[model samples]
Target: MRYVSLGSGSKGNATLLEHQGRSLLIDCGFSRKTLLQRLELARADAGQLEAVLVTHEHGDHAKGALALCEALDIPLYCSQGTAIKMDWTEHARWRSLTGGDLTRVAGMSVAAVTVPHDAREPLQFVVEAAGLRVGVLSDLGSLTPHVIAAYQGCHGLQLEANHDPEMLRKGPYPPGLQARVAGPYGHLSNAQCAELIRRIDWPGVQYLTAGHISEKNNHPDLVGQALALAFGSTSRPVHLLAQDQVADWCEF
Candidate 1:
């Protein structure tokens, strides 16, 4: 399995996962033109996408999903809440799955795990193919026991490190915005993200990508430092996803 991040941040969020000739797009947050450009940079052909899995209805995650799927003539999967939020009329191409149900997409067995995000019925995905598994956890306020168990044993992980608490505390966001960001259903602080990495099966992971970092509240250096703190002396290669460019492919 190989994965490439098109971009990951407040500006936009998308990832492409491939195995053999099949490909799955985790999100399409950017505009169609921009998504195509990024996919080109990632060396991914959008035509190979078998399906698109949306994490939630947030604009930065789902904004371009339908357009891309329509252009590719592929299916788009999301929770019922997300579908309703989209108000999509293209019922034939939409697949709605409840959390915990497994489905096959592009030769991978996919299971959606409900997550604590501000969006209605948000979900994270764990996809497995040919004995290799990849877990994607992002846009969540807090990490729960369910998150840990669901994400354990992943070969590749894209976890959210949205902000540095100190940066957020001193950042320009107003009081209400700060509270929302730090709230239980907001986003993961760097410290919280590191703690979650510590408790999960990190050693088993072959690749770690700290994703959805805030340009205003978090630094890429801080993300690495925090993750290092979590792994202690047992450090592993970490990849940082950027909002403006595609990340290098991580294969397992």
Candidate 2:
């Protein structure tokens, strides 16, 4: 199995996972043109995608899912609440999935895990194929025990390091917005992200990618420091995802 980030950050987010000649897209935050361009960067084409999975209804996550799926005549998978929030009922290609539900698509098994976010019934995912597991987690405010359990034993994992708490406190965002971001239902702080990696089943993970960064409140150096603290003395590979470009593929 192999995976690559099409883009990751506030402006948009998407990832492509390929296994056994089949490709599955996780999220479609960009327009058709932009998505196509990013796909080309990874040496893939729209015709190769068997389905698109959405994690939530946020614009940066679900914005282009329906249109792209409709245009390509591919199935769109998401929580029932996410589908309703996006008003995707009219589309015949929409496939509803509830949190904790496992389904197969594009020759891969996907398990949706519910997450706590401002959006209605948001979810993250754990995907598996050929006995290999990869977890895609982002946009959740806090980590729950369920999340930790769901993400265990991943061959690869993409976790969000959205912001630095100190920077967020003094940053440009107003107090209310800051509170929301630092709140229990908002994005994870660098410290919290570090804590999560410390508590998860880290030894089994071969590849670790940090993503969905806040350009204004977090720096790559800060994220690196946070990860370094959590992964002391370990040589497991780590990759940082960028918002503007496609990332190099990580194959296992």
Candidate 3:
């Protein structure tokens, strides 16, 4: 299996996973045009996308899901709460995904793990194909035991490192916004994200993409330091996803 991140950040987020010529899009946060351009840059074809899976209703995660699916004549899957929150009352191509249910989509087994976020019903995905697992985890403030257990044995992982707590506390965001960001339902700090990496079966992770980084409150250097701390003497290739560019493909 191989994956490419179209982008990852507060502005927008999307990931494309492919195996054996079949592809799945995790989110379509960018407009159709922008997403298509990114796909082109990555040498990927939208026509190959079998489905689009939405994590939540947040604009940065779900803004262009419907449009993309409609344009491609592909199905979309999301939690029922997410559908209601987005006001997608009815759509012929929409499929409801229940967290914890292993469903087959696009020839892959998708495990939707519920997460604690501000959205009505947020979910992160761990997709398996050809005996390999690739996990897409982000947008949660805290990592529960369930989350950790679900991500075990992943060959590829894209985990969020949203901010540096010290930077966030001293940054330009207002007090209320800061409180929300630091709250239990907001985003994970660099330390928190590293802790999750530590708690998980990191030794088995072959590809690690540290993503969903806050442009204003976090730096790639800090994320690197945190990852180094988490992995200790262990070595692995780490990719830091930027908001404006398509990341290099990671194949496992």
In order, what is each prediction's RMSD in angstroms?
1.3, 1.1, 1.1
TM-score against native, each model: 0.97, 0.97, 0.97
- Global lDDT of each candidate: 0.89, 0.89, 0.90
Worst 10-residue stretch by lDDT in candidate 1?
228-237
Q: Per-residue lDDT for 1-252 in model 1, tens only?
A: 899889999989998999997999998899989999988888787778899999999999999999988888999999999989888635777999788989999999998999998987898899999999999889889878998899888888888999998999999999999999999999998888888888785557788888999999999999988887775536576778898889999988
Model 1 residue 117 lDDT? 86
The true-versus-predicted C-alpha distance at residue 49 of model 3, in Å, is: 0.4
Compare the candidates by lDDT and give the number of the best one.
Answer: 3
Q: lDDT per residue, candidate 2, 94-160, as tens digits? A: 9989998999999999999998889988989999999999999999899889988898888888999
Question: In model 1, which runs have C-alpha deviations exceeding 4 angstroms?
Answer: 232-235
TM-score-wise, the better of 1 and 2 is 2
